[model samples]
Target chain A: MKFLCLECNTAMEFKETATPDQGSLTAIFECPDCFAEFAMHMNPWETQMLKSLDVQLGGKSEAAQPMQMVRSFLNQQNPDNLTAEAPTVSTEGGGKCPFTSVVAEAFQEPVEATGPVWTPEALARLERVPSFVRSMAKTGIEEFARENGHTEITAEVMDTARGNFGM
Target chain B: MKTYKDLPADGGSNIIGQVTQQVNRLQQRLASVRHIVAIMSGKGGVGKSSVTANLASALGLRGHSVGVIDADINGPSIAKMMGVRGQRIDYGDDGVKPALSPLGVKVMSMDLFLKDDETPVLWEAQTQKDAFTWRGTMEMSALREFLSDTEWGSLDYLLIDLPPGTDRLPNLVDLLPNLGGTVVVTIPSGVSQLVVKKSLTMAKKLLNAPVIGVVENMAAYVCADCGKTEDLFPSGHTEEMARQFDVSLLGKIPFDPRISIASDEGSVFVDQHRDTPAGRTLIALAEKIEAFFNHEV
Candidate 1:
């Protein structure tokens, strides 16, 4: 049967077999040209469909979002997967991804509110901060249990719509 | 390619839990000591060990029971300076009970552990990891095991004489739980000032422990014959830096030949020269330090 490499857009052939109880739950298929290994549990039909849609496969492919691809692969592998029992992704301060959620929450709040307040200037400051320095600051904050004391910088630019007039 | 490894076939969920429980137990044991202060210097030759020994002595004289652990694995001047030089440490059932000075401050150092005075701790990353980690781990194991297994009874302070720079001291700080604060020592010079800033930044970055303040060593020289104060190195930078960092400016200790003599004789300056400037400054610093920890500042 014909199949396509999910990582590389190369056409390939596969030998069809009856659902012999393959001891391993995971399926491993090797690409002839690229010599790249691809693993998935999709049957011949689904592989053909994906190939027809021009989906690329293998090492670090940019075909789709990795997590989405993972989810799709899981769904195809087993409908009775245990991911359904996985808790909802929390974005609050207590969530696993607390920094992003906290920043988002801080941005949403007004300056005088109970939560962390950030100005546009502060956002620019965050962007301007080197990743290493930011990491150091973050580590310091966590280790010392201190506030995120970053001062942001911003500059005013004239808008084209406003022209020469001041807004 | 994404590398994925499965859990051990043993499938024991208790490994992480057991390890965590053990670590928590260790932390509790370490927290038994009321206060632990690491004495650090930005640069070597700034009299860090001398300051630590004297400060511990001053604290001891003040009726506060203090333990001095010399964390300088490479150059341990504490044991010798404290007058317990060449004394062999006896390991009891509990742990290594640090030898006591004449003033009764418990002292421990890497020197005590070495077989010979010439034995060098030539530790490398491939051989012993970073010098900091090796020294720090040795210190933690020594101090923690000492505190936990031994009969220290009740103690007010555990003063650690840390190695020079932000480099080695941070590692020791990491191992020490519930560290009261740090006393950063520096000489009165631009180079020392730069190094002190590095030390300050290191303390801020590495640990959350409070900085007691910047203690300026060799602040000035007083000629005995002339009876005039001369600025040996640049002055006021220590105080200025302390003010900038929002920490106290402990005190400036003058360069005194008498201090060197006292240290050589295995005695503290405070005991030898009570009225001398360095001795008096240390006493004042002790008082202020007491106030700081006691919340009377």
Candidate 2:
């Protein structure tokens, strides 16, 4: 897709650079016609969207994703929230789940599917998969099981899903 | 129940739009600075920050507009060495104005935020005893803030003094995409070269950028009284490291006792001791860098 410069309405060259603060990467649109450079914060949604389409944005491994930058960029604008949250630094005031903003496009906790709960054994089996691909495998198994009207994923259900689906 | 330790230093609940706006502001702030070149050494205690501070001064001596971003978020020594150790930044209507060094080079570092030289960078709220516990992601965000918030009016070269690691700050690759290249620093020792090689690998493999060359710091000790030079480490060893890495051996920065003393005194060695042998070599090293910048082999 051609990215146009919003200010000049001209054909813009897409450029990206890290913000000076090193908080997050910014996608810059440089307009040759008007010499205008526009940069926007690179957000998690874009990364998630790219992942869903089987695209790797910037070749970073999933093991250590760009969640920090996504979170940092958001927090920088709201510095007041920082002091307020400072008192919440204790273990009791636990923050968001680390894995929620990672792994795949959905970036959400696995749902129960209203059919069957994945036993601890099954979850352990899935966890054994390499981190980069384990999430992919889980999404595959869950989808296959849910579509076929299976409530819980047992060893037998896993075998059927494995035969029918691959991450 | 979860705590801050379980998540990132700061959490992103529902502020994607606001974050994007800050990013735009950061880009605009750094638009004037050009050709960001990072200096890194894989291993710590290799004098990378000292080399960076002096190199910025050396470049300024050559009449080029230069600015340095101390990318060593946890261990910020660039500001201290460059004569702005305890200086705080000025934030006005436009943005943060980087501290001016004695030799007119712009410097931005985590040190600028500290109230005093002894102040601990308690970036982590529930601080840990070990310095290594400073999260890389947290440092990366702080770095992002330094870059975005600092207003450096157009510069010829922006040298980034990267922290001592190839993998430690992986986010640096994304932060400064158009790095002119990297200048790897090392001391002439088997141990130093072993780690320096990894630093070279970081640029050639990880960052996929060019290795401009290597500056062998503490390569020799020059006697101030008699002008006698003692090559502490064999010259052939450092040369071989450069040859094996396929990068130019830029210069051997002599270990002038005054260099460290000057750094401790909040001075750029090259600027304070310009008449010394090491200082002259640093200037020549700056010329070599200039030649590389011009794409002249």
Candidate 3:
């Protein structure tokens, strides 16, 4: 039977087309797109052939333990494409569009709105300004907020706008 | 033929989105310009366009990269004054290519769109009595479209020749992000200065634009034969405005009849006569402008 390539989900041919050996729990599948080989558990093992292969392969005997041994092999090779049965790789910000990396690089730097957010009380005081100079007065207040490093517009900022900035 | 090519190519489905796109396009186009200045007068009969043409020519001749935008939507004369009148704007791989003048100043104007000298730009609104009543909103959009679409590659200076009054100032002023400043033009008469003061206050308080200085055009008459200066109009208001408004007093220009004559003849007086008193003053004005941008003054 054909199996799905873990990385690209493409149908890939198995190295051995016949029915899996009885009680041989693991089978090897190769992905054609990424050329990564992964071991998938096929059935339970009834014999100690795994132990014999482990001795021949000269590796840790733990790799021959059970159905979980083959899954660990799949985890190492296709780490990013895992599911629960088949889990998707989800990061902190969730899945990103494949096309957005270049655009994200451009917007990496953002202008910080460092000034204090305008207070309603101060905004009401600014309401006394003539319509003609309203924008100018608001800008002066914000500029004062930024230059003075205040996180919120207080009575002091309004006083400065009135006296120094000619509001 | 009607040429609306400067307009954004949308068929009017999304108005706000299209205008925002146009603004984004203009910001990208003009980002390379170092200084954005406009020559404005509070009233007409101030020879503002002539100053713009000659000043841009002087700057260009001084080896500075300068471009002139005749932002006078209704009465565009920079094309004629710069001797680039009747040159048609074309579309190449770039956007609307501004026509270059004989002095190498990239000039853009609505005059280039008219078929002939007699054709009037009547952007009419539907009225009960008048069929050809021009609309202010239409004028603003057209000016914005032209300003946004022109492919001015790069420059050290872009001097916009604004139409007189505060009405259309927003049309051009809204397009510039960092306007180096405006060179407010006015004659020396009290009436002219009084009107110009309105513009200064508006710029400082309303527009929040920096007013670099005031240029007193037609301030005096300098006799060519006797080297005597004559007071052509009341001569004290410019300095008074400068002192009261806290704006700099850039040099003054004498009322030279030849200045007007040369303008009408489509010749740049600053380039033709550098030794004449008026020419020297023009060159001096150009120097002061250079110093202002250079932060030397």
Candidate 4:
């Protein structure tokens, strides 16, 4: 999608993308002629559509790895050798696009100040969950704990959350 | 006032370049494969995966290197039927190595990556509330990865076993513009043909891919003791459908309980029971596929 600056009647260039906030992505575009910047906020569905396409918002600096989309986005994968860790992306030399990091960070569970704290036992159990779904499960369990008025997430809290998850 | 065409590019996103790279990777990966065929049955429960597994084995037994892609992303069964389930896939220089069946056919399927029998394929999403908007695209991306990122080296034939839907072929054709041909599978029942005809039209007219022919699965049931064949589904509709489509009736495979048994046991039926009625037909079906590519049929 292209953005045009009405005042200058010139096309805008992609400047950078901010880290997703609550599943929404904000991309900043600047008019080449006027040097004026504008932000485009994409809702959750649009963000997901971009993620599903497996393309970076800005130009990709590095070549994509084999099965990158499946390895990165597939939740609840087999724990066998099939769970081999995807190679880490090296953002060294500042060559990688900022949107690449945004994409990676988008899937991560946000650290909220009011979120329930995980006890040692609960954290260990969360580790046992398949790595792919571990973040999602942790988020769900913490949300459940908070909803149930539990400030500290212990094994009992995890057990109580398990019922909500049908696990 | 500037227009869309006035813009040099999509504001440096280079989305088209990235997509072109994806297509180039798929074409480069498939360069070594001589023929790529898609086996599809619009109607469910028609034994399309069974036919694919046995056909790959048959071709492998004939000294032809074969690879099978379980394109049915959500309901993949080819890896299990080909006896490659639970096999560890490693990353190679080219791509992720595919699982090898007993008869040496390479196999790639979502089944190989699933955690267990009961685990369903699910993508990591912030919310599945409105997944209908992007789920199909996710599945297609998975299929594209299976096609381009698997290390299927120097194959004589690569058969893609598609899911039960008339819309699947068009999705595949979008990914593989030069897909060799399509082998339509159906039972002898008119109900089966009713849906199979839509797939036939999809492959023949809509997409314009070559229709290799039709295979009548479970055309009849062979009695083990009496050695008599009984019509399983009011026979003769497959022939009528084939005549209507102007495609050859490739083979008629009788219903053999062992075929199901073998699939459940993760064994190729044709390999273990080559002399059986269904086994013989499966082997012949593979030969017919070869001939179709060679311009002999």
Who wins the DockQ comparison? 4
| Candidate 4 CAPRI grade | acceptable
Pairs that clash in candidate 4: none
Q: For each candidate in turn, give its C-alpha RMSD to the true structure in angstroms.
A: 25.4, 18.4, 29.5, 6.7
Best first by DockQ, ranked: 4, 2, 1, 3
Q: List the residue pairs that clash in candidate 3.
A: A23-A45, A25-A43, A82-A87, A83-A86, A83-A87, A84-A87
Ranking by lDDT: 4, 2, 3, 1
The CA lDDT at B236 in model 3 is 88
User: What does the lDDT read for residue B128 in candidate 3?
Assistant: 16
lDDT for residue B167 in candidate 1, whole number 0-100: 65
Docking class for candidate 2: incorrect
Report the C-alpha lDDT of model 3 over B174-222, residue by residue, as the tens digit: 6675678899999988888888988888777655467878888988998
lDDT of each residue in B1-297, candidate 4, tens digit only: 899999888887777766765667677778899999999989999999999999999999999999999989999999888888999986676568899999999999999887679878888766778999988888988898888778898999999999999876767877888789889999988888899998898788766578899999988999999989898889788888889989999999999999999999899999999998998999899899989999897
Off by over 4 Å in 3: A1-167, B1-14, B124-134
Q: Each model's TM-score, in the order given?
A: 0.57, 0.60, 0.59, 0.85
- Kindly state the number of residue pairs that clash in model 4: 0
Kindly indicate the candidate among 2 and 3 with the higher DockQ: 2
* Cα distance off (Å), candidate 2, residue A58: 25
**Mind giving the per-residue lDDT tens digits that candidate 1 earns over A78-128?**
111122212222222211211111111211111111112223443344435
- DockQ of every predicted complex: 0.01, 0.02, 0.01, 0.32
Say what the interface RMSD of candidate 2 is: 18.1
Which tens-of-lDDT digit does each residue in B1-297 have in candidate 1? 211122121111122332233245335544557888888876888889999999999999999887887777567789888988666554343233467889988876656544356655432111222334233443434333333333344578888887776766555554565778999998878888788888888887777688888798889998888868999986778888888788888999988998899888897888878788888999988888899988997
lDDT, candidate 4, A28-126, per-residue tens:
889888899999999978988888886776664443355667755676566453333334222333233122322443444331322365565776687
Off by over 4 Å in 1: A1-167, B1-28, B122-151
